[model samples]
Target: MNPLLKKLQELTTKLDSTSETLDSFRVFHGRGKIYPGLEFVTLDYYHPVLLLTLFNQPPEHWLNENLPLLQENISQKIQTIVVQHRYAPGDPSEIVYGELPEQVFAKRGALSFHLNLAKQQNIGFFLDIEPARKWLEQQAANRRILNLFAYTCSFSVVAIAAGAEKVVNVDMSSAALNQGRANHLLNGLDKNKSQYLAENILKSWGRIKKAGPYDLVILDPPSFQKGSFDSVKDYTKLVRRLPELMPSGGLVLSCLNNPDLDDQFLLDIFNSACPQATFLFRLPAHPDFPDAESNRQLKMLVFELATG
Candidate 1:
């Protein structure tokens, strides 16, 4: 048996047991674990498809030969297989096996969101942010939300599902925001209660602030977007303005995905910029995507502004 196959099976057993309720999740994240530069996940599990993403380097020729063995050995009944290369510039994801669907929906709790698995860099919804979604649902009741870099508005769906009064989703991509609007419609959430702003967040603070005095502010941004955001340098700028957007005693769900920066990077920024805002806790990444180093995992810090 191939060593990778054996490890995959073992990991699948552990992940599948607890993930029966979930329709989309990371089956493996092997950045510095089971395999270097490889990630394997099952998306739209209800539709039943597998996605294999390669990072750090291009895939070896052996992958074409070995993927079949992998598909045969896996426990789930995967109808489609897609492969994406993270570092390859402008390279489109390929459907390695079976047919690619026009649309795929994945369930989390009672809500379902569309997943874009073809012709894009991202599959639309991020599986690793499941913990934050769960947390938001628990605390979202009757609160106003501002979701920054709101890719496809997955968080908005969670907020709406959890009875949020209103949500504003801001992203630079009009296409993404349109998809977000569709997601809200798909879940039958009131479209009037949500606003989709398609503008550069940093430049549109004047516009964003108008919708604010928000009860819960959620920030989840890309690690690096050329000419847009550089986490180490630009993240602090967003942190400095937190006080202006959120009201006293409001909650802030801040997320950072840059592996190079540790949790303290965010903690220190929050502590310094908004001294009154207290760090509540770190949201845990799903167990299925464990990292050998906790700092490298997706970091979500819940902070509450001080009440006067």
Candidate 2:
């Protein structure tokens, strides 16, 4: 029922030169997602980022409709879609993110959601790692939780609801935090348990530290952010400082979202950057997911201070 997805189906069916399994894919600026037929997998590692289309057996004509949208432009190199969903007998897997699937994909225990369905962008809830939120909820009681770049505050709200003494959600947009606060209310959380500020994380870490040695720290930063961050240069600065915010043996959930950056990259960054900490473990996904790696969008590191 999504117009963009419907359009994607139309374009792929009409591709001039089609392949069974497309390895090198690209996303030219367009109104929709693009991909090959359902019989194979399609992706562009260099383009925008990591657009994917993998599926079982889907309708060729239906998938073809969306191919036009994936055509590459020599100028802007970006992946058109992040990943595609295939289901329903007439379903298509060799698809992209243009139109989100109709499925509601529930958030697992101790979790809330903030996602945009049917778009070739990030999912609202990042449903891949619900276990991390559950862990936060289990540990939040009587402690302060600092959530940085707290997009929807799903982490903050769950922390507060789980009995965190207080929570401070920091980001660059108060409006976004406002939605986060609303999520707190949605879960019947106490407003007094949480606080929010909109500020650049890099520019404001000292002030954040002044806020104190929080019980828990969560950092799932974007790979490349135009407005507030540069992943390659800024990530270490941010990653290194996280330990200072936690008390001895406190918890730190450090994450990286750029699929281009592998899980090993995160492990190395945290090990070197936060020397005072010992690795806990990576979080797991909910039962609904068939592909576990998708949740690897960000590699999460759990650590407790060595000094503590």
Model 2 poorest 10 in a row by lDDT: 24-33
Residues 1-308, candidate 2: write the lDDT tens digits: 53334433444543324532222223221211222222244332321233444444445665565454444321232333445553324332333433334432224343444433334244344544566776787778888788988977888877777778888888886867877877787677888888887889888977888876787788867777897886777778876886677655477787776656776776777778877777878765434332324543446667776554
Model 2 lDDT vs. the true structure?
A: 0.60
**TM-score against native, each model:** 0.89, 0.62
The residue ranges of model 2 lying beyond 4 angstroms of the native Cα positions read: 1-60, 63-123, 247-249, 285-287, 290-297
lDDT of 1 by residue, 1-308 (tens): 65556665764565467645446666556663645434432222334667777664545665766688767765564567787766679646788888877777887767888877767777688878889998999999999999999989999998988899999999999999998999999999988889989989999999999987787899898999999998888888888888788756598899999998988999999888889888989988778667778888889889888764
The TM-score between candidate 1 and the true structure equals: 0.89
Prediction 2 TM-score vs. true: 0.62
Q: Which candidate has the top score in lDDT?
A: 1
Which residue runs of candidate 1 sit more than 4 Å off their true CA positions? 1-4, 7-22, 36-46, 56-60, 74-76
